[model samples]
Target: MAHYKAADSKREQFRRYLEKSGVLDTLTKALLLTSKDVVLVALYEEPEKPNSALDFLKHHLGASAPENPEIEALRLEVAEMKEKYEAVLEENKKLKTKLAQYEPPQEEKRDE
Candidate 1:
């Protein structure tokens, strides 16, 4: 039937679109699959169906995944460094203030 052919044509067009846009390649790479077709089949046959396919892929691909231990450790180290930097800045400010008391105040330049 013409209707069946039209539906098949639409599906084929969609497949081509997916292929041309590199979605197939990206999905395959993210899932670490040797074959891109397997990515499509996996998504289609996922046992615990997710509400959003994009979210499901993102969750699996580390977008919303748990932080890696090394990365978490680096984050904490950065925070500690920032705290140290702030403390040093405050100490520098106090030292400058104390030095200012021991130094002569310069005369302000008056604009004529």
Candidate 2:
């Protein structure tokens, strides 16, 4: 009985030491890393089926989308808008270059 008690006391002391030294915290972190590893392994074992999600999206969108004629009109409008945007960007760049041309040139110093 006394030997058992001594062993129990040593066990408790070791437990306290582990707790005080942050061993338990480290052990918990290790367990969390292990759990993440397991999740990664599962993810790598089987690729995600992205097509299913895309199919779901297509099914939902196909129901609500406008007819082909309307889509064609929108495509033409987008093309026109893109052309206008490019024209504006070209005008902006030309204006910047023109402004730089109007700046006074630095005077060269003559050597004495």
lDDT of each: 0.69, 0.58
User: How does each model score on TM-score?
Assistant: 0.53, 0.33
Stretches of candidate 1 exceeding 4 Å from the true structure: 1-41, 45-49, 62-66, 108-112
Candidate 2 clashes between residue pairs 3 or more apart in a chain or in different chains: none
* Per-model C-alpha RMSD: 6.4, 17.4
Q: Candidate 1: which pairs clash?
A: none
lDDT of 2 by residue, 28-112 (tens): 5554565444533432343442323323323433434667898899999999999999999999999989987886554522332
lDDT (Cα, 0-100) at 1 in candidate 2: 100
Instruction: Name the regions of candidate 2 deviating beyond 4 angstroms.
Output: 1-67, 104-112
lDDT of 2: 0.58
lDDT, candidate 1, 1-112, per-residue tens: 9999997896686567556655666676665664435545565566654455556455555578788999999999999999999999999999999999986667633432
Top-lDDT structure, candidate number: 1
